[model samples]
Target: MIIVIEPDSDVPIYEQICNQIMEGIARGQIKPGHSLPSVRVFASDLGVNMHTVNKSYHLLEKKGIITIVPKSGAVISSPQDFNESSFNRLKDEFKPLIAESLVVGMTHQQIQNLVTSIIEDFTKNQK
Candidate 1:
Protein backbone atom coordinates (compact mmCIF):
# COMPACT_ATOMS: atom_id res chain seq x y z
CA MET A 1 0.00 0.00 0.00
CA ILE A 2 1.22 3.46 -0.79
CA ILE A 3 0.92 6.12 1.90
CA VAL A 4 0.89 9.67 0.70
CA ILE A 5 1.34 12.30 3.36
CA GLU A 6 -0.08 15.76 2.81
CA PRO A 7 2.48 18.12 4.22
CA ASP A 8 0.02 21.02 4.09
CA SER A 9 -2.69 19.31 6.14
CA ASP A 10 -3.36 20.31 9.70
CA VAL A 11 -3.12 16.71 10.79
CA PRO A 12 0.11 15.69 12.51
CA ILE A 13 2.65 13.60 10.62
CA TYR A 14 2.38 10.71 13.03
CA GLU A 15 -1.41 10.76 12.78
CA GLN A 16 -1.21 10.80 9.00
CA ILE A 17 1.06 7.79 9.07
CA CYS A 18 -1.15 5.94 11.51
CA ASN A 19 -4.31 6.69 9.53
CA GLN A 20 -2.79 5.46 6.28
CA ILE A 21 -1.58 2.22 7.80
CA MET A 22 -4.99 1.53 9.28
CA GLU A 23 -6.67 2.42 6.01
CA GLY A 24 -4.41 0.00 4.15
CA ILE A 25 -5.50 -2.80 6.46
CA ALA A 26 -9.16 -1.85 6.11
CA ARG A 27 -8.86 -1.88 2.32
CA GLY A 28 -7.03 -5.21 2.37
CA GLN A 29 -3.98 -3.78 0.67
CA ILE A 30 -2.01 -4.79 3.71
CA LYS A 31 -2.85 -8.29 4.89
CA PRO A 32 -2.42 -10.08 8.17
CA GLY A 33 1.17 -11.02 9.02
CA HIS A 34 2.41 -8.39 6.61
CA SER A 35 5.50 -6.82 8.12
CA LEU A 36 5.80 -3.07 7.98
CA PRO A 37 9.06 -1.32 7.29
CA SER A 38 11.08 -0.63 10.40
CA VAL A 39 10.51 2.63 12.16
CA ARG A 40 13.86 4.06 11.16
CA VAL A 41 13.46 2.87 7.58
CA PHE A 42 10.01 4.31 7.12
CA ALA A 43 11.06 7.57 8.74
CA SER A 44 14.02 7.79 6.42
CA ASP A 45 11.88 7.03 3.41
CA LEU A 46 9.20 9.54 4.40
CA GLY A 47 11.76 12.11 5.55
CA VAL A 48 10.05 12.30 8.92
CA ASN A 49 11.41 11.81 12.41
CA MET A 50 11.97 8.27 13.64
CA HIS A 51 9.84 9.03 16.69
CA THR A 52 6.93 9.90 14.41
CA VAL A 53 6.90 6.49 12.77
CA ASN A 54 7.42 4.82 16.13
CA LYS A 55 4.43 6.67 17.55
CA SER A 56 2.24 5.57 14.65
CA TYR A 57 3.21 1.94 15.11
CA HIS A 58 2.46 2.06 18.81
CA LEU A 59 -0.89 3.70 18.17
CA LEU A 60 -1.82 0.97 15.69
CA GLU A 61 -0.87 -1.67 18.24
CA LYS A 62 -2.98 0.01 20.90
CA LYS A 63 -5.98 -0.20 18.58
CA GLY A 64 -5.37 -3.91 17.96
CA ILE A 65 -4.77 -3.33 14.29
CA ILE A 66 -1.10 -4.34 14.42
CA THR A 67 1.24 -6.28 16.62
CA ILE A 68 4.64 -4.76 17.37
CA VAL A 69 7.43 -7.06 18.29
CA PRO A 70 10.75 -5.94 19.67
CA LYS A 71 12.73 -7.01 16.63
CA SER A 72 10.21 -8.54 14.25
CA GLY A 73 8.67 -5.16 13.56
CA ALA A 74 4.94 -4.42 13.21
CA VAL A 75 2.58 -6.87 11.53
CA ILE A 76 -0.98 -6.35 10.42
CA SER A 77 -3.61 -8.22 12.39
CA SER A 78 -5.69 -10.94 10.77
CA PRO A 79 -8.97 -9.75 9.28
CA GLN A 80 -10.61 -12.78 10.82
CA ASP A 81 -9.59 -11.46 14.22
CA PHE A 82 -12.07 -8.66 13.79
CA ASN A 83 -15.06 -10.67 14.98
CA GLU A 84 -18.67 -9.59 15.47
CA SER A 85 -17.93 -8.11 18.89
CA SER A 86 -15.05 -6.16 17.44
CA PHE A 87 -17.28 -4.81 14.70
CA ASN A 88 -19.93 -3.83 17.24
CA ARG A 89 -17.31 -2.11 19.35
CA LEU A 90 -16.03 -0.20 16.33
CA LYS A 91 -19.60 0.74 15.43
CA ASP A 92 -20.26 2.00 18.93
CA GLU A 93 -17.03 3.91 18.89
CA PHE A 94 -18.07 5.75 15.76
CA LYS A 95 -21.72 6.15 16.74
CA PRO A 96 -21.43 9.84 17.55
CA LEU A 97 -20.10 10.72 14.11
CA ILE A 98 -22.71 8.51 12.42
CA ALA A 99 -25.44 10.28 14.37
CA GLU A 100 -23.98 13.60 13.30
CA SER A 101 -24.10 12.43 9.69
CA LEU A 102 -27.75 11.60 10.09
CA VAL A 103 -28.43 14.98 11.68
CA VAL A 104 -26.82 16.65 8.68
CA GLY A 105 -29.44 15.22 6.29
CA MET A 106 -27.73 11.96 5.45
CA THR A 107 -30.37 9.24 5.36
CA HIS A 108 -29.56 5.71 6.50
CA GLN A 109 -30.22 4.40 3.02
CA GLN A 110 -27.88 6.97 1.51
CA ILE A 111 -25.12 6.03 3.93
CA GLN A 112 -25.66 2.37 3.18
CA ASN A 113 -25.53 3.02 -0.54
CA LEU A 114 -22.37 5.03 -0.17
CA VAL A 115 -20.71 2.31 1.87
CA THR A 116 -21.73 -0.27 -0.70
CA SER A 117 -20.15 1.76 -3.46
CA ILE A 118 -16.99 2.21 -1.47
CA ILE A 119 -16.69 -1.52 -0.87
CA GLU A 120 -17.23 -2.22 -4.53
CA ASP A 121 -14.54 0.24 -5.50
CA PHE A 122 -12.18 -1.25 -2.98
CA THR A 123 -12.73 -4.77 -4.28
CA LYS A 124 -12.30 -3.70 -7.85
CA ASN A 125 -9.04 -1.99 -7.03
CA GLN A 126 -7.80 -5.16 -5.37
CA LYS A 127 -7.98 -7.00 -8.67
Candidate 2:
Protein backbone atom coordinates (compact mmCIF):
# COMPACT_ATOMS: atom_id res chain seq x y z
CA MET A 1 0.00 0.00 0.00
CA ILE A 2 1.21 3.44 -0.88
CA ILE A 3 1.31 5.94 2.05
CA VAL A 4 0.82 9.61 1.29
CA ILE A 5 1.21 12.07 4.16
CA GLU A 6 0.25 15.73 4.19
CA PRO A 7 3.08 17.60 5.84
CA ASP A 8 0.93 20.62 6.57
CA SER A 9 -1.91 18.80 8.31
CA ASP A 10 -2.53 19.22 12.02
CA VAL A 11 -2.29 15.46 12.46
CA PRO A 12 1.09 14.07 13.23
CA ILE A 13 3.06 12.22 10.57
CA TYR A 14 3.11 9.02 12.60
CA GLU A 15 -0.66 9.04 12.99
CA GLN A 16 -1.18 9.57 9.31
CA ILE A 17 1.12 6.63 8.64
CA CYS A 18 -0.71 4.48 11.16
CA ASN A 19 -4.16 5.33 9.82
CA GLN A 20 -3.18 4.74 6.19
CA ILE A 21 -1.70 1.38 7.08
CA MET A 22 -4.88 0.44 8.95
CA GLU A 23 -6.98 1.47 5.96
CA GLY A 24 -4.72 -0.57 3.70
CA ILE A 25 -5.33 -3.62 5.84
CA ALA A 26 -9.06 -2.92 5.91
CA ARG A 27 -9.09 -2.69 2.09
CA GLY A 28 -7.01 -5.88 1.82
CA GLN A 29 -4.30 -4.12 -0.15
CA ILE A 30 -1.90 -5.37 2.51
CA LYS A 31 -2.74 -8.86 3.65
CA PRO A 32 -1.87 -10.80 6.77
CA GLY A 33 1.79 -11.82 6.98
CA HIS A 34 2.79 -9.23 4.42
CA SER A 35 6.13 -7.74 5.41
CA LEU A 36 6.32 -3.97 5.53
CA PRO A 37 9.37 -2.04 4.46
CA SER A 38 12.06 -1.47 7.04
CA VAL A 39 11.89 1.69 9.10
CA ARG A 40 14.99 3.25 7.59
CA VAL A 41 13.92 2.64 4.02
CA PHE A 42 10.37 3.74 4.64
CA ALA A 43 11.59 6.91 6.35
CA SER A 44 13.87 7.73 3.45
CA ASP A 45 11.13 7.14 0.91
CA LEU A 46 8.65 9.28 2.83
CA GLY A 47 11.24 11.93 3.59
CA VAL A 48 10.50 11.64 7.28
CA ASN A 49 12.57 10.68 10.28
CA MET A 50 13.19 7.03 11.04
CA HIS A 51 11.77 7.53 14.52
CA THR A 52 8.43 8.56 13.03
CA VAL A 53 8.07 5.32 11.12
CA ASN A 54 9.22 3.34 14.13
CA LYS A 55 6.62 5.07 16.31
CA SER A 56 3.86 4.25 13.84
CA TYR A 57 4.90 0.61 13.60
CA HIS A 58 5.05 0.28 17.37
CA LEU A 59 1.62 1.87 17.74
CA LEU A 60 0.20 -0.54 15.19
CA GLU A 61 1.72 -3.43 17.11
CA LYS A 62 0.31 -2.13 20.38
CA LYS A 63 -3.14 -2.14 18.79
CA GLY A 64 -2.63 -5.75 17.56
CA ILE A 65 -2.64 -4.68 13.94
CA ILE A 66 0.94 -5.72 13.14
CA THR A 67 3.76 -7.81 14.56
CA ILE A 68 7.25 -6.43 14.52
CA VAL A 69 9.79 -9.17 14.09
CA PRO A 70 13.46 -8.67 14.78
CA LYS A 71 15.56 -8.32 11.59
CA SER A 72 12.57 -9.31 9.42
CA GLY A 73 10.71 -6.01 9.87
CA ALA A 74 6.97 -5.72 10.49
CA VAL A 75 4.25 -8.09 9.31
CA ILE A 76 0.54 -7.41 9.19
CA SER A 77 -1.54 -9.43 11.62
CA SER A 78 -4.61 -11.45 10.79
CA PRO A 79 -7.88 -9.82 11.70
CA GLN A 80 -9.09 -10.55 15.20
CA ASP A 81 -12.37 -12.24 16.02
CA PHE A 82 -15.10 -9.84 17.12
CA ASN A 83 -16.86 -10.43 20.40
CA GLU A 84 -19.08 -8.63 22.90
CA SER A 85 -16.33 -6.37 24.22
CA SER A 86 -15.37 -5.47 20.69
CA PHE A 87 -18.94 -4.64 19.81
CA ASN A 88 -19.30 -2.45 22.87
CA ARG A 89 -16.05 -0.71 22.11
CA LEU A 90 -17.20 -0.03 18.57
CA LYS A 91 -20.56 1.29 19.77
CA ASP A 92 -18.88 3.56 22.29
CA GLU A 93 -16.50 4.88 19.66
CA PHE A 94 -19.27 5.51 17.11
CA LYS A 95 -21.88 6.86 19.51
CA PRO A 96 -20.80 10.48 19.36
CA LEU A 97 -20.43 10.46 15.60
CA ILE A 98 -23.89 8.98 15.15
CA ALA A 99 -25.34 11.50 17.58
CA GLU A 100 -23.62 14.30 15.73
CA SER A 101 -24.98 13.03 12.46
CA LEU A 102 -28.50 13.04 13.87
CA VAL A 103 -28.06 16.56 15.23
CA VAL A 104 -26.89 17.64 11.79
CA GLY A 105 -30.23 16.36 10.36
CA MET A 106 -28.98 13.17 8.73
CA THR A 107 -31.76 10.64 8.50
CA HIS A 108 -31.29 7.03 9.61
CA GLN A 109 -31.25 5.89 5.99
CA GLN A 110 -28.66 8.48 5.09
CA ILE A 111 -26.35 7.37 7.91
CA GLN A 112 -26.91 3.73 7.00
CA ASN A 113 -26.06 4.45 3.39
CA LEU A 114 -22.91 6.31 4.37
CA VAL A 115 -21.77 3.42 6.55
CA THR A 116 -22.59 0.93 3.80
CA SER A 117 -20.49 2.86 1.32
CA ILE A 118 -17.50 2.83 3.68
CA ILE A 119 -17.92 -0.88 4.33
CA GLU A 120 -18.10 -1.47 0.62
CA ASP A 121 -14.79 0.29 0.16
CA PHE A 122 -13.21 -2.03 2.71
CA THR A 123 -14.83 -5.15 1.29
CA LYS A 124 -14.14 -4.47 -2.35
CA ASN A 125 -11.22 -6.92 -2.31
CA GLN A 126 -13.15 -9.61 -0.46
CA LYS A 127 -14.65 -10.77 -3.72
Candidate 3:
Protein backbone atom coordinates (compact mmCIF):
# COMPACT_ATOMS: atom_id res chain seq x y z
CA MET A 1 0.00 0.00 0.00
CA ILE A 2 3.03 2.28 0.08
CA ILE A 3 3.27 4.04 -3.27
CA VAL A 4 6.02 6.48 -4.07
CA ILE A 5 5.38 8.80 -6.99
CA GLU A 6 8.33 10.30 -8.84
CA PRO A 7 6.98 13.41 -10.46
CA ASP A 8 9.95 13.75 -12.78
CA SER A 9 9.95 10.18 -14.01
CA ASP A 10 9.04 9.27 -17.57
CA VAL A 11 6.05 7.21 -16.56
CA PRO A 12 2.74 8.96 -16.17
CA ILE A 13 1.26 9.51 -12.69
CA TYR A 14 -1.73 7.27 -13.32
CA GLU A 15 0.48 4.46 -14.61
CA GLN A 16 2.70 4.78 -11.56
CA ILE A 17 -0.37 4.46 -9.36
CA CYS A 18 -1.61 1.42 -11.24
CA ASN A 19 1.79 -0.31 -11.19
CA GLN A 20 2.21 0.26 -7.46
CA ILE A 21 -1.24 -1.10 -6.73
CA MET A 22 -0.53 -4.18 -8.83
CA GLU A 23 2.78 -4.68 -7.06
CA GLY A 24 1.04 -4.37 -3.70
CA ILE A 25 -1.40 -7.06 -4.72
CA ALA A 26 1.42 -9.31 -5.95
CA ARG A 27 3.23 -8.86 -2.63
CA GLY A 28 0.09 -9.76 -0.72
CA GLN A 29 -0.02 -6.37 0.99
CA ILE A 30 -3.41 -5.91 -0.61
CA LYS A 31 -5.43 -9.08 -0.48
CA PRO A 32 -8.31 -10.19 -2.64
CA GLY A 33 -11.62 -8.51 -1.73
CA HIS A 34 -9.77 -5.66 -0.04
CA SER A 35 -11.28 -2.25 -0.60
CA LEU A 36 -9.13 0.57 -1.91
CA PRO A 37 -9.47 4.11 -0.60
CA SER A 38 -11.93 6.41 -2.32
CA VAL A 39 -10.57 8.26 -5.33
CA ARG A 40 -10.80 11.61 -3.54
CA VAL A 41 -9.01 10.31 -0.45
CA PHE A 42 -6.35 8.47 -2.42
CA ALA A 43 -5.68 11.48 -4.64
CA SER A 44 -5.46 13.71 -1.58
CA ASP A 45 -3.05 11.31 0.07
CA LEU A 46 -0.89 11.00 -3.03
CA GLY A 47 -1.13 14.71 -3.79
CA VAL A 48 -2.34 13.92 -7.30
CA ASN A 49 -5.52 14.91 -9.07
CA MET A 50 -8.65 12.85 -8.49
CA HIS A 51 -8.86 12.16 -12.22
CA THR A 52 -5.47 10.46 -12.11
CA VAL A 53 -6.58 8.11 -9.37
CA ASN A 54 -9.84 7.45 -11.17
CA LYS A 55 -7.98 6.60 -14.34
CA SER A 56 -5.67 4.25 -12.46
CA TYR A 57 -8.63 2.53 -10.80
CA HIS A 58 -10.39 2.17 -14.11
CA LEU A 59 -7.28 0.69 -15.70
CA LEU A 60 -7.03 -1.85 -12.90
CA GLU A 61 -10.69 -2.68 -13.36
CA LYS A 62 -10.18 -3.12 -17.08
CA LYS A 63 -7.35 -5.57 -16.38
CA GLY A 64 -9.64 -7.54 -14.04
CA ILE A 65 -7.52 -6.85 -11.02
CA ILE A 66 -10.18 -4.80 -9.20
CA THR A 67 -13.89 -4.14 -9.31
CA ILE A 68 -15.30 -0.66 -8.83
CA VAL A 69 -18.65 -0.45 -7.16
CA PRO A 70 -20.76 2.69 -6.89
CA LYS A 71 -21.19 2.72 -3.12
CA SER A 72 -18.46 0.30 -1.99
CA GLY A 73 -15.54 1.78 -3.89
CA ALA A 74 -12.88 -0.51 -5.43
CA VAL A 75 -12.42 -4.12 -4.36
CA ILE A 76 -9.64 -6.48 -5.42
CA SER A 77 -10.80 -9.27 -7.66
CA SER A 78 -10.54 -12.87 -6.50
CA PRO A 79 -8.37 -15.46 -8.22
CA GLN A 80 -11.48 -17.23 -9.44
CA ASP A 81 -12.17 -14.27 -11.66
CA PHE A 82 -9.18 -15.06 -13.86
CA ASN A 83 -9.73 -17.37 -16.82
CA GLU A 84 -7.90 -18.82 -19.79
CA SER A 85 -8.42 -15.71 -21.85
CA SER A 86 -6.72 -13.69 -19.17
CA PHE A 87 -3.77 -16.06 -19.21
CA ASN A 88 -3.51 -15.87 -22.96
CA ARG A 89 -3.67 -12.10 -22.94
CA LEU A 90 -0.95 -11.89 -20.33
CA LYS A 91 1.21 -14.32 -22.29
CA ASP A 92 0.81 -12.24 -25.40
CA GLU A 93 1.77 -9.10 -23.54
CA PHE A 94 4.88 -10.76 -22.14
CA LYS A 95 6.01 -12.02 -25.52
CA PRO A 96 7.48 -8.74 -26.68
CA LEU A 97 9.25 -8.15 -23.37
CA ILE A 98 10.78 -11.60 -23.54
CA ALA A 99 11.80 -11.00 -27.11
CA GLU A 100 13.35 -7.69 -26.20
CA SER A 101 15.37 -9.35 -23.46
CA LEU A 102 16.65 -11.92 -25.91
CA VAL A 103 17.49 -9.25 -28.45
CA VAL A 104 19.48 -7.47 -25.76
CA GLY A 105 21.66 -10.60 -25.42
CA MET A 106 20.07 -11.86 -22.24
CA THR A 107 20.17 -15.64 -22.13
CA HIS A 108 16.98 -17.59 -21.52
CA GLN A 109 18.32 -18.88 -18.22
CA GLN A 110 19.15 -15.40 -17.05
CA ILE A 111 15.68 -14.15 -17.90
CA GLN A 112 14.13 -17.13 -16.13
CA ASN A 113 16.26 -16.58 -13.05
CA LEU A 114 15.24 -12.96 -12.89
CA VAL A 115 11.62 -13.94 -13.14
CA THR A 116 12.06 -16.55 -10.42
CA SER A 117 13.77 -14.05 -8.15
CA ILE A 118 10.97 -11.55 -8.59
CA ILE A 119 8.33 -14.17 -7.89
CA GLU A 120 10.17 -15.33 -4.80
CA ASP A 121 10.63 -11.79 -3.56
CA PHE A 122 6.95 -11.06 -3.90
CA THR A 123 5.55 -14.32 -2.50
CA LYS A 124 8.09 -15.13 0.18
CA ASN A 125 6.10 -13.82 3.13
CA GLN A 126 2.72 -14.99 1.87
CA LYS A 127 3.28 -18.61 2.88
Candidate 4:
Protein backbone atom coordinates (compact mmCIF):
# COMPACT_ATOMS: atom_id res chain seq x y z
CA MET A 1 0.00 0.00 0.00
CA ILE A 2 1.22 3.49 -0.88
CA ILE A 3 0.38 6.10 1.70
CA VAL A 4 1.22 9.73 0.99
CA ILE A 5 1.45 11.82 4.10
CA GLU A 6 1.43 15.59 4.05
CA PRO A 7 3.14 16.74 7.19
CA ASP A 8 1.80 20.27 6.81
CA SER A 9 -1.82 19.29 6.43
CA ASP A 10 -4.27 20.05 9.21
CA VAL A 11 -5.16 16.40 9.48
CA PRO A 12 -2.99 14.46 11.88
CA ILE A 13 -0.44 12.06 10.45
CA TYR A 14 -2.07 9.05 12.12
CA GLU A 15 -5.49 9.96 10.75
CA GLN A 16 -4.00 10.45 7.31
CA ILE A 17 -2.44 7.01 7.53
CA CYS A 18 -5.75 5.53 8.62
CA ASN A 19 -7.67 7.25 5.84
CA GLN A 20 -5.24 6.12 3.15
CA ILE A 21 -5.32 2.55 4.40
CA MET A 22 -9.11 2.57 4.35
CA GLU A 23 -9.04 4.04 0.86
CA GLY A 24 -6.61 1.34 -0.22
CA ILE A 25 -9.00 -1.28 1.10
CA ALA A 26 -11.89 0.34 -0.75
CA ARG A 27 -9.85 0.37 -3.95
CA GLY A 28 -9.00 -3.31 -3.52
CA GLN A 29 -5.31 -2.61 -3.31
CA ILE A 30 -5.32 -4.33 0.03
CA LYS A 31 -7.59 -7.35 0.16
CA PRO A 32 -8.92 -9.37 3.02
CA GLY A 33 -6.15 -11.44 4.68
CA HIS A 34 -3.50 -9.07 3.35
CA SER A 35 -0.78 -8.32 5.86
CA LEU A 36 0.29 -4.76 6.44
CA PRO A 37 3.91 -3.75 6.90
CA SER A 38 5.20 -3.93 10.42
CA VAL A 39 4.82 -0.72 12.39
CA ARG A 40 8.57 -0.21 12.51
CA VAL A 41 9.09 -0.84 8.80
CA PHE A 42 6.11 1.23 7.79
CA ALA A 43 7.19 4.07 9.97
CA SER A 44 10.69 3.95 8.55
CA ASP A 45 9.31 3.91 5.01
CA LEU A 46 6.91 6.75 5.70
CA GLY A 47 9.48 8.68 7.73
CA VAL A 48 7.08 8.98 10.66
CA ASN A 49 7.26 7.88 14.25
CA MET A 50 6.35 4.27 14.97
CA HIS A 51 3.86 5.45 17.52
CA THR A 52 1.91 7.21 14.78
CA VAL A 53 1.60 4.01 12.81
CA ASN A 54 0.70 2.10 15.94
CA LYS A 55 -2.06 4.60 16.69
CA SER A 56 -3.37 4.25 13.16
CA TYR A 57 -3.33 0.47 13.38
CA HIS A 58 -5.10 0.54 16.72
CA LEU A 59 -7.73 2.86 15.33
CA LEU A 60 -8.24 0.55 12.36
CA GLU A 61 -8.60 -2.33 14.77
CA LYS A 62 -11.19 -0.42 16.77
CA LYS A 63 -13.08 0.30 13.56
CA GLY A 64 -13.13 -3.41 12.65
CA ILE A 65 -11.13 -2.86 9.47
CA ILE A 66 -8.12 -4.87 10.62
CA THR A 67 -6.97 -7.26 13.29
CA ILE A 68 -3.64 -7.19 15.10
CA VAL A 69 -2.34 -10.63 15.86
CA PRO A 70 0.20 -11.24 18.57
CA LYS A 71 3.70 -11.55 17.10
CA SER A 72 2.21 -11.74 13.59
CA GLY A 73 1.13 -8.29 12.37
CA ALA A 74 -2.00 -6.55 11.12
CA VAL A 75 -4.38 -8.27 8.73
CA ILE A 76 -7.29 -6.80 6.85
CA SER A 77 -10.70 -7.92 8.03
CA SER A 78 -13.40 -9.23 5.73
CA PRO A 79 -16.80 -7.57 5.49
CA GLN A 80 -18.28 -10.65 7.15
CA ASP A 81 -16.34 -9.74 10.27
CA PHE A 82 -18.51 -6.72 10.82
CA ASN A 83 -21.57 -7.20 13.04
CA GLU A 84 -24.73 -5.20 13.54
CA SER A 85 -23.01 -3.15 16.22
CA SER A 86 -20.40 -2.14 13.71
CA PHE A 87 -23.09 -0.88 11.35
CA ASN A 88 -24.81 0.88 14.20
CA ARG A 89 -21.55 2.57 15.07
CA LEU A 90 -21.10 3.64 11.47
CA LYS A 91 -24.62 5.09 11.40
CA ASP A 92 -23.95 6.96 14.60
CA GLU A 93 -20.73 8.33 13.14
CA PHE A 94 -22.41 9.41 9.90
CA LYS A 95 -25.41 11.10 11.50
CA PRO A 96 -23.59 14.30 12.34
CA LEU A 97 -21.92 14.50 8.95
CA ILE A 98 -25.25 14.00 7.15
CA ALA A 99 -26.95 16.53 9.37
CA GLU A 100 -24.17 18.99 8.76
CA SER A 101 -24.43 18.52 5.02
CA LEU A 102 -28.17 19.15 5.15
CA VAL A 103 -27.65 22.18 7.34
CA VAL A 104 -25.18 23.45 4.77
CA GLY A 105 -27.97 23.41 2.14
CA MET A 106 -27.01 20.20 0.43
CA THR A 107 -30.00 18.47 -1.13
CA HIS A 108 -30.66 14.76 -0.76
CA GLN A 109 -29.92 14.19 -4.41
CA GLN A 110 -26.66 16.06 -4.18
CA ILE A 111 -25.61 14.05 -1.16
CA GLN A 112 -26.56 10.81 -2.86
CA ASN A 113 -24.71 11.71 -6.01
CA LEU A 114 -21.60 12.55 -4.01
CA VAL A 115 -21.78 9.21 -2.27
CA THR A 116 -22.28 7.38 -5.56
CA SER A 117 -19.36 9.18 -7.12
CA ILE A 118 -17.08 8.34 -4.20
CA ILE A 119 -18.07 4.68 -4.30
CA GLU A 120 -17.52 4.54 -8.02
CA ASP A 121 -14.13 6.15 -7.68
CA PHE A 122 -13.14 3.80 -4.92
CA THR A 123 -14.25 0.63 -6.70
CA LYS A 124 -13.48 1.47 -10.32
CA ASN A 125 -10.19 -0.42 -10.33
CA GLN A 126 -11.88 -3.57 -9.07
CA LYS A 127 -13.81 -4.01 -12.32
Candidate that would win on lDDT: 4
Every candidate's lDDT:
0.85, 0.90, 0.94, 0.95
88: Cα error in model 1, Å: 5.1
* Cα displacement (Å) at residue 20, model 1: 1.3
Question: Residues 11-127, candidate 3, lDDT per residue (tens digit)?
Answer: 999999999999999999999989999999999998889999999999999899999999999999997899888899999999999999999999989999999999999999896
**CA shift of 25, model 3, Å:** 0.8
Worst 10 residues of 1 by lDDT: 118-127
Error of 1 at 100 (Å): 1.7
Candidate 1 structure quality by residue, lDDT tens digits, 1-127:
7999987799998899998887787677888899999999899999988998999989888778889888899988876666776688789978987888899999999988988997787677565
**Cα miss at 82, model 2 (Å)?**
4.8
lDDT by residue (58-116, candidate 4, tens digit) is 99999999999988899999989879999999999999999999999999999999999
lDDT-wise, the better of 1 and 2 is 2
- TM-score computed on alpha carbons, candidate 2: 0.86
Q: How does model 3 score by TM-score?
A: 0.95
- Candidate 1 regions exceeding 4 Å error are 83-85
* Per-model root-mean-square deviation over C-alphas: 2.0, 2.0, 1.0, 0.9
- Model 4, CA-based lDDT: 0.95
Please report how far candidate 4 places residue 68 from its true position, in Å.
0.6
